[model samples]
Target: MSNITRPWWKDAVVYQIYPASFHDSNNDGIGDIPGIIQKLDYIQSLGVEVIWVCPMYASPQIDMGYDISDYEAVHPPYGTVQDMEVLIKETHSRNMKVILDLVINHTSDQHAWFKESQSSKDNPKRDWYIWRPAKYDSEGKRGPPNNWRSFFGGSVWQWDEQTQEYYLHLFCTEQPDINWENEEARKAIYQSAMTSWLEKGVDGFRIDTVNMYSKPMDFPDAPVQDPSTPWQDASLIFCNGPNMDKYLDEMNAILSRYNAMSVGECPATPDRARVIRYVSAEAKKLNMVFQFDSVDVGQSKPSKYDTKPFNYTLADVKGAISRTQSLLDGTDAWTTSFIENHDQARSVSRFGNDSPTFRTRSGKMLSMLFASLSGTLFIYQGQEIGMINMPKDWDIAEYKDIDSQNFYADALARNPGNKAVKDFAKAGLQHLSRDHARTPMQWTAASPNAGFTGDKVKPWMRVNTSAQDGINVKDEDADATSVLNFWRSMLKVRKNHAEVLVHGTFQLVDENNEKVFSFVKTSLDGKDKALLVCNLSDEENRVPEFEGVELAEAMLLLDNPWEGRIYLID
Candidate 1:
């Protein structure tokens, strides 16, 4: 619902690439920028208008590339700054825009700024990061200044022995949160990093952890949701701080100069009122925001890594989308709708059945569901080929993700010697592990490394074993009935009816139908109208007749048993 007169991003379809697992051109087992350059043709073929590559910034890989050690340079494994320049130029040549992941919430402890800040309390750059002295308890035991906890678990404050103080890190200990309250630090980030990238012809950014930049003036203890797990919900104190608008407005001042297409990761901003304030065109804060309401449908409370299982129903899915669309209907705030991303499990495995008997059919149904939505569509890497979760038999050691590894260990510590603890940990992995989506992209079944690397080289992460059996880009590309081709057709449908799907008014038609997610899109002027119907369940469903509309020959998007159809109603 942006008030901007020109919203060029509305028609854009974004494809997210996890650079490490995408393609490894050097055969070193890790995917790099050069490998991305090699796959430009393949990316362009998917009909995506924008490519949002996850962080490739220089880092120690403590949290993959999110712990940026250098803002201006690319990571060694990814490539050089010169390679990035070439990538921007090449992407532009293909008429596709490129947006890099911006991780300004924190910097690696190895970063020069953090290093200087942690050197001594009286250092010139000491104020650049959040620092505090230890608070001793009544019994004289020293502890962190506050009760805040890290999103990855444990205390948020990492003690700096040299400085005799602690630095804040909402994530890993290696990533220290920067102090946005420091005007000098803010100016330095803008001048040295953001503007520098814009000058290099980069489109915009997917700002990482956007809402956590502004911390409360008094670092307060969050309301303890569970006394046993005191750190389960510290977001109440740290997230969406008072100065978030002020900071974002400063960012918009720089972004507006280039007319950038900026989207922020705002998991902390759930309400429509707060979200609109950031994304409203008149406010000019950001073009769009990624929210967690829809994705958090079946997500367990307290923490996503909690022992509880995901049991979201079909009605929950319908309600999530319907409520979101209703809130943003007439406003300038827009929805950045998506099913899967780097930090999420594969949508096919989560929402739809990934079993061999229903995999392809459910994939097509999901694709249809995504295409019918009235917002920008984002497709994650390997999503087009119906890539699923890791093999069921794979052991925990095979998982390389830091977040997953940490959670498993923490769960075990909580329930010592209990067999149910392992079961609980395994269940979380099966349902919500971020590593599920980080597996190496499957290119071809014939290659030893799934054509993601050289024949003799083992991939940095294991490839989906099913890639060798049939689920691969090469096979799907050749087969007309494959998931890849179905995605192509769905994209084509969205493009052909852009007026309805992209810019029209969304209305849920069959709200009470528990087995079907059905909605109608009407042109702004009401001349054009299209109704989308999808069978959310496995059983065959008959379309319920409408009162005023005549049902002509329906454009069957997906065949019987997996019912999906579009009709032009007069």
Candidate 2:
């Protein structure tokens, strides 16, 4: 048997739940913690070891829960902290672990701390946030501390009339970047807030934008990526700044004392050396990080979402993941694998099959590639059911995601009459949009809303139009060869073959195939290896090249294709 003493994460798969979109118990059209409690069995039945719930803290909902109004209190709409305790207890009742999302780099302007800090220049908490005086131009017009722009829109600074100074906000003007250099702020962050949750028994944390805490002491303008565009300039300064690892080390020290799993949303690292420095297990910084390279499958550049659609092939997808995994191998470092999350469009639409014939097959194919790799696996809600992208024609008024809404508003304000703006929104559908994956879970094929929320109850967003005709968990559960079955079987194989599938050496096998992505996984303990191959395209694949690796004694583990053989290599 696989070592039971190892942490659940060592070889486990996790499922991410966006609380607002997960499930609703009161039929109030909003999903809350009590509703999450109702769905715990459904989550556990998937064999998931960890359930990572996004922020449920007190928030103004401007940027979802990323803008925190109160660090200690749970959002009233989600549930009270007492409800959270019950959910955590329910998660632990089974063998499953529960992880919480931590967003500590900034706080909502509505937060008591920020409210007090912005009260006056002489307030005891005035220095708790990054605030600076306005720089004067030759024309005597006041400018911000620097030319930095907010990730959401125009300027990173909002003037506080009482202080006559501009405060820094990397995201929204509402979320001012906290001064981590302040000892009291650090105390409240790591000691009072973080430990309170840990002491209450949360298993781990998935830190949002973990590298954004530290910044250059002297705030200055960042060299622009696209000089013509200001959006590109905003991300340059904050992500993975100079003092990033210092902040990480300090955070790690606090988390490590309790032996909790720490996964960071890290980006902007130049190379593998930087990745290693941030995530090395011995360094006690981070256990894992979600690299954007694999997720940027269809993008030409890292952050420019509107530029253009680059042609993407299966080999390119395989290549990106292979390179990332290879570079982080054997370094006591690892990465995260997810196809759909709150931040991106759905995987089924972007990479897999949206049609009838290809839907289940492609979902299984992608699941195999991610689960067989040497890292943690994350399954966004509705992914196993093969949920595709949202309707491309969705109007800007339909989106609730702050980033998407801000972009839409910015485009309209810049060029209201421009048809290019229309085309831009359509193309933007292909890049980043939360609507693609935030649809309600499709529980049954019979119900109107797929049995997610009640019929009269208005869901936060509409369910994918395809749920009736294409995707539903009930149908897949009954269909033996469905994507749902494939997902469960894949998890079974991963669990049963933990040594070979989890702690194994990963090698990319086929580089020339345009449509087929194949890799070999060999156990670190020198056990027999397995070939995990998938033809991501629609055409039938017949591989006769690697003939010596025949499996005479091998039985088929899971055949995703309905008509395909369980035992192949014929």
Using TM-score as the measure, which candidate wins?
Answer: 1
Model-by-model lDDT, in order? 0.84, 0.76
Question: TM-score for model 2?
Answer: 0.94
Question: Residues 455-521, candidate 1, lDDT per residue (tens digit)?
Answer: 8988889878889867899999999988899888888878877777777788877678878888888
Overall local distance difference test of candidate 2: 0.76
In model 1, state the lDDT of residue 55: 92
Q: Candidate 2 lDDT, tens digit per residue, 286-305?
A: 88888777777766432345
